[model samples]
Target: MSFIGIDLGTSSVKAVLVDDRQRVLATAARELTITRPAPLWSEQAPADWVAATLETLRRLKDTAPEAFRRCAGIGLSGQMHGAVLLDARDEPLRPCILWNDGRATAECAEIETGEPASRAITGNIAMPGFTAPKLLWVRKHEPDIFRRTRKVLLPKAYLRLVLTGDAIEEMSDASGTLWLDTGRRDWSDRMLAATGLDRSHMPALVEGSQAAGRMRPELARELGFDAPPLFAGGAGDNAAGAVGLGAVDPGSSFLSLGTSGVLWRTTAGFEPRAGSAVHAFCHALPGRWHQMSVHLSAAASLSWWSSMSGQSEAALLGELGGQIDRPSPVIFTPYLSGERTPHNDPQLRAGFLGLGHDTDRKAMTRAVLEGVAFAFRDGKEALEDGTSPIGEAMAIGGGARSDTWLAILADVLNLPLRRYRQAEAGAAFGAARLARLACTGESPEAVCAPPSGEADIFRPHPDRAAAYAERHALWRRAAEVSHALR
Candidate 1:
């Protein structure tokens, strides 16, 4: 049988069709737009998500009719920490506040002060990206909408509601809401109270790998389905990507160079870092936990450079690859959208130091790449220095497409990195695996198997490692001083 995996990503909603053998049969994507009504605020209309899903599924049906008809289950993965408020009729009260929105900085500080137990329970630093702070921002700034909010759901859960008429919030995604107790894999009463929210505003929780609900029969038939497919409790995009990359086993880890970069490792039990930058959250599968160190911008810095320079990524990188003979004298800090991980400060801004008359577009490009690499090194060091030590990691996402960047990353962290076959399929492929487990009762180990084959390997260069080590140290000291000045 075939299964469908729908991933509600920030830029688009992607749907993948996979057979029982875990081979992707067909895929579809619909682009989405993020609206910024004000600086540091990101919003997306919930109705657009529903429309995107339907359009994507329709495309899947039209493109691969046989695979679509044989579909046995559905799974969902989405951008985490988004707040979708619903009124009494289950209609969205307003556009969702996304994971990257930084307007809630003051609200995050409020949460840290009012809810001292937050870190102990959620196992996360109170960053403005989390849902609790966004809610607090709404409560303080838009009280009327806060009062009308009868339900709070993440982006994928809102899509799940439209598909199955059920309000399902999976564990892995909910863990990022700052309202869940990561150790218990459930919502914390105290956390809810801290946000002036209650159980009534929350959805029924489900394990990330378990079945959430079945598709409504009428809706299934209208979509030209042969049966009402079982809907699985899919994970957050990072965990889903881990499953796709076969990083479920303890100690298995990956470094994703997406819009926001993350270094995550799987563990057998919860390991909360009381005052560290590490984030402890439940894994997609039950009985397992994962820790993450996040950097708010990774490939995004490159995107910014490309846009500002009017150079395509390929052109910029092509120019950049030729400059390996020497390191750029400039040092850049990639705090363009503020930062998380080691420095939980949102007001921090990005800057470049040591620019001279000779500095050109190519030097600036290399500096931008080097800056993100250093930020990633910061996270990797935080994780390795903490309870979890990462020896190696699978490299995935848009930046992973750059051999030069990945090589730079390898030396910066001095860690071996592997790229897997079908690495670009990412979260949607893993969501499809979750769908198989939910419907066919297949073990995660069997369904979410490690990469059937290896594609590439990147190892550190000793001389470059030493050079980057010195530069990285300088970056940390300079960043501290810059943050202080900010």
Candidate 2:
């Protein structure tokens, strides 16, 4: 039996095919567009995600028909916390509000004010990026649409509806909704009521590796499948990425730099650390949980700089290797879309500080990269109060392709970093692994064991790590003053 995993990302949808032996057979992806109708609004047509999923699956089939021939299960992972409302007939009520949209800041505050035990229930801070705030925003602003909404779905779960005609949500993905009780691994009634919703609006809950539904018969035939594929409940991008990197047990950690940067570590038990703004969410695996520290903008900031300066990100980072005497004097705060790890402020904007006459394109580029690295360190510090200590963390994401950035990350965190063969295949690959676990009765430990290939390891430089220790302290204080820009 073979399994397929689809990841509905912020910028694209990726479908990956893997065999029973757990080796990747084929993979496909399709880019998506984000619509910004207002200053802080980011949305995408829910149909776009479906179209991309189908097209990517078609591409995967074309790439390796043999893999699809014996496909047994399909899993879904996606950008977490996007609110997709459906009417009575299951049609979308509006464009899907994405995870990065900050329009619901006021609504987030309202939820916190209304629900006094929010932190205890959700194990997260009230933020605009959460799904419940978007729901509140709709109920207050678009009452007509809100009144007609019958079901609310997350990004990838919407595909589950079209593929299997099932309305289901997995715990790992739903944990970010600000309505889920992280400690209980279920929806919190108080939190849902805070958003003007209840259990009726929520979908059937399942664990990430549990079976959700069977494939829709008509669509299964159209895709030339002999039997209905088992739909495995999937996870959010961060949790799915952890699976892909084999970070499924306690002390297993990874540093992920996607559209956003995440420092995720899996734990054996559910521990809520909302006091420090640390996100404690249900792990994709059952009876397990994870702590997350997020930096809202990572590669997105580099992309922005690449567009602003005429050099490609690769061309700019291509110049940053070799020995460095000291860190760049030009300090850049890569908070283009605000921040989430410690401050949780949605209005903070980035800036370039300590600019000198000698500051050229390379220094500015290094500053941008180092600044994001600093943000990651800030996240690590926030998680310092936790019980677990991360050993060597795996590095995966678009930014991880840059060796200089990885070196900076290792040095700043004072930990070794490992780069694997599947750096580009993040969440989709993990979803496929979850699919395998569901299709077969293999334990997560058996399915997501140690790495097969010899991974390249980068160790921290002692001197640079010491320098960053001091610089990060300054960067921390700067973040406070920089909040004035809000």
Candidate 3:
């Protein structure tokens, strides 16, 4: 049988069809837009998600009709921490408050003050990007909507509601809401109360590899399926990507260089280092957890530079070739959208230091690349403190396409970086694996095995590593300066 995996990303909705042997049969995608009504506020209409998902599925089906018809299970992965508030009739109360929205910064403190055990309970510091804080922001500013709110669902759960008419959530995504008692993998009564909400506002929880519900009959027929397919309780985008890479065992790690950068390492149990802004959340599979360091801008910094310079990302990097001989004379801080890991300061902004008369676009490009690598190094240090070392990491995401960047990252972090076959498939491919496990009742080890082909490895050069070590220290000092400026 074939399985379908759908990912609801910030920029687009993507679907992939995979056969029983875990080979991707077909792929499709539909772009999505974000609305910024005010500064630091991001929103997206719930209807738009539904529309994009349906269109993407249709496109996937068209590409491989036979495989699509034999689909046995459907798995979902989506952007985490979005608050999709629903009313009595289960209709969205307003556009979803996105994960990157910073409008609820003040509410984060309110939660910590109201729930003294919040950090201990949620295993995280109060962050405006979490769902609970967004709800608190709404309660204080948009009281009428808050009063009308009946249920809160993460982005994928909202899509799950539309597909199955069930309000079910899985562990990995729910762990980001700041409502779950992450250690126990369940909703926290105290956490909900602190935000003036309760258990009723939460959905039934399930493990990511379990079956949540079957698709609605009408929806199934509309999608051209012969039967209502079993829906697997999938995962948050990061965790889903881990499953796709088979980084499920403790100490197994990967770094994602998407619009945002993340250094993720799987663990055997809950490990919270909230003081360092490290996110300790449940993994996609049972009995596993993960710690991650996030930098809000990774490839995004390159995107911004590309737009400003009127040059494509590929063109800008092409000028530098596959590697750089030494660190750029100029140092850059990639705080374009503020930062998260190691420094949860959203007010921090990016800057370039030591610009000379000879500083050209190529130098700036190299500095941008090195800046992001330095940020990952910061994350690596934070996770390494008082925990097992991350000896090596697999690289994934759009930025992983850059061999030069990967080489730079290897030198900066001083850890080998591996790029696996089919790395481009990412979270959607992992979601398909989760669907396979749920449908076949197979072990995660068997279903979520890493790709079979030999991986391309990026090793650090000794001389460059020593040079970057000194530059990284200077970069840390510069980051401290940025913090002071903020």
Instruction: Highest TM-score: give the candidate number.
Output: 3
In order of appearance, the predictions have TM-scores of 0.97, 0.97, 0.98
Give the winner by lDDT.
3
Which TM-score value belongs to model 3? 0.98
Tens digit per residue, CA lDDT, model 2, 373-454 = 9999888888876464677788898888877888888998898999988656778888998888888878998887746677
Q: What local lDDT score does residue 90 receive in model 2, on the 0 to 100 scale?
A: 91
lDDT of 1 by residue, 404-435 (tens): 88888888888999987687888998898898
The C-alpha local distance difference test score for the whole of candidate 3 amounts to 0.92
Following a full C-alpha superposition, what root-mean-square deviation does model 3 have from the true structure?
1.1
Summarize candidate 3's per-residue lDDT along 1-486 as a digit string, tens digits.
999999999888989999998889999999899898997888999899999999988998899998898899999999999999999999999999998888888999999999999999888998888899999999999999999999999999999999999999999999999999999999999999999999999999999999989999998998999888999999999999999999999888999998889999998999998999999999989999999998889998998889988999999999997778899988999988678888887778888988989899999999999999999999889989986788899999889999999999999999999998786899999999999989999999988877678888999999999999999999888888888887
Which model is ahead, 2 or 3, in terms of TM-score? 3
lDDT of 1 at 332: 83
Model 3, which residues run further than 4 Å from truth?
none
Per-residue lDDT value at 16 in model 3: 95
Kindly report which residue pairs in candidate 1 clash with one another: none
User: All models: lDDT?
Assistant: 0.88, 0.88, 0.92
